[model samples]
Target: MAITNNRMICRTVFAATLLTAPFQIFTSAIGQVYPSLTLLFALMLFLFYDVSKVLKTSLTMKTWAALVLVQIISLLWAVDIREGIREIVYSFSFFLVFGASMQESKRNLRSLTLLIIAYSVLTLSQSTLVIYFRLIPDVKIQYLQGHLAEIFTSPNTLIDLFGSERNNVLDEAKSGGFEVNANTGAAWVGMVGMVTMGLAIGLRRKLLFFVSLFHLVAVFFSGSKAASLLVCCLLALMYLTVYISKKFTPSRFAILISFVVLLTVAGSIVVAAGSATDFGQASSDTLDTRKLIWAHAAVEFLKHPILGQGFGGWSETFQAYAWRQKISDGYPPHDTLIRLWSQSGLIAALVGAAFMIAFSVEVLTLVRSGSRTAAWIGAGIWCGFLFVSIQGLGENWGLLGTLRMSPFIAACFALSRALGYYTSPATRSSVLNTSVRQIKYV
Candidate 1:
């Protein structure tokens, strides 16, 4: 498929918007903003962008069914009218804009790759700026959030409302670096780490490798075990997926498989090698606390198996359930399935999971069956998203009132749409007016 002039321009603007605006709006004045400003850019692109190309296929039978089911169930369970609509629109918009991006432009890919680099470098610049102004110490310059204890615990968790003796207890074990919010800072670094890895694979640039190395260094400070594990898991998954898919129709699969395997394995090993020093060891107590929370959340799922007590009520429900069990950290289950079941019920979980599964399969098909640009973007967004989804299972990023929809999450959904996964390849061909038939994202 030919890279059209229009696609290039649109993607350039989109990538730039993501890289720049978030920093200015959220990170400009204060330490670090809650609910990262990238969310704003994602909404801007989804809501205002000229993306009718995706809309035509968006009303497909599958999407429509999922939307209707969620909406109906939401009406019954989604107590907050505005929040429910936002969630549904968020889910829908992710599909619509990305679905239209199927005709990938090399220019756009180049633009995206560059934008990622810019985002990564901002770490150095941000740190320098912080030190220069004495906003933070040279060594203590926060990577993502401001406070050190906030890195390990939520500063504004509102635990006081629960009447617990230890309300919003910040982890005092600042044995090493800055005390930024672990979820926000570390998760962001881990995500950027994955992005760099993906770009290194698709672009094969010397710069991407160094960029990846640097991002992992930042990840070291995040002290988020789940986020670190998540990056490795996604990279491993990507190489495996690429290898298994390449074995088929594309005879070039062997060479590509070998290449990806070598890169992924070697990269992981290198990252792990220094991890002994780079990554601080977590106490057994911390590990135990996480397990305890997860375990308690699991039990709540079984008790209220269906018809969760509506959106935004997870806390009220979680608190009520936890109080019975007497393990009162006041944490809503960090796991996605548990929180999802407790809030939206099985049906909502089913629809969301279906979209994810379908998106992954479609992405694989599109990449394996089509041009390089589309394949890279398709694979990049899909793998990046899957990495987060795996983490989301153990974290509460998408649990309604927590962090809202992630920009990275929205990007993955949008990229999937652009790969034209929702509509058949034939439909995309007709739009681009090209004979380049999409086989599937291999």
Candidate 2:
């Protein structure tokens, strides 16, 4: 009875965590505080359930731990120790979330799927709201921000709405929803949408297919060129996965061909429309600015090639470099790996690379494994992972360390690993044997 109660509590907490994940887009005090608290609570419950199970170390986990340790050690040399500590805390939160997810997944794969679907639906609803506001001529961006702030605030009051007064809002004309950056919002929506579509195909769900299509439309309303391109690539990968997984019947072949042609036409239309608008010019300028920031970040990385500048050291280094070069200030590195390499050094980079390689290999192995259901699901997640990785090249928030999308990315890693374990032949055989023994005793 005690064990049953504990399991119930654990499931409730994890479900809450997954459902609230979409709200992580809010850059408010609540947004920051709530996720951390919930994730920590969930992690605690998971650990309480089975400390050994949660702590079971693998090569990937070890690499991740080493990476975190190096970052912590680098704080001794970090220009701003306080800032470095904060960044480390944020980064380590992801590790905790990942562990909790692994434990939860072991107990109930179906529940996890339901929770994920709920998360995607909530995220899509938010996107729809943002798109609605964007289309309203009377609603200003600040007005939308204030409304969202109120919705997220405690006691339903708008008093002291956190991050409401933005010092630097990116692309005011774009539909960023509650996020500070439009591109970041678009990327987040796109990722969730991709996962939804993947599941739709894998599970043959019509509702999820429509939800994903809505998310795709929301991405367009966001006016992010990079996100648009990334979504296209993600869709293409999904199609490719379908092609590889299924037998090519005549009817199926025609359907696939139609999908390809339709996607091409739709993409062409979007491209042509964007080029005709000022958004195209703005996107071009943004890319140019990113290139400049990347060049500066590269130089900074070279300055401390071995140890690199410690976490939070990049701002000061870049400031000095920009001053010397008479460049504008307050720009981020924008790229994930570049930011990690610049801030944490080569050790972190190497560890990150190793983890990615190991993760990819594991996912690939699952995709080729005996379980047909697991294979398709794994392929879907693989595409989502690739989407995040490719999108990370142009943005800083899609990787493991960043606060914005790190939890989502961590969830991706956890889900992939969970699928791999639950679908393995060994696990299947064990379950079969256990069932047989139980039947004989009965």
Query: Highest lDDT among the candidates is held by which one?
Result: 2
lDDT of 1 by residue, 265-297 (tens): 565455556455534224233446668777765
Q: Each model's TM-score, in the order given?
A: 0.63, 0.79
Off by over 4 Å in 2: 1-5, 24-58, 137-140, 144-172, 245-280, 320-328, 401-404, 427-442
Indicate which candidate wins on TM-score.
2
Clashes of 2: 0
- Residue pairs clashing in model 2 are none
**What is the Cα-based TM-score of model 2?**
0.79
- Residue 253 error, candidate 1, Å: 13
lDDT of 2 at 402: 35
Cα misplacement distance, residue 247 of candidate 2 (Å): 12
Residue 440 of model 2 has an lDDT of: 16
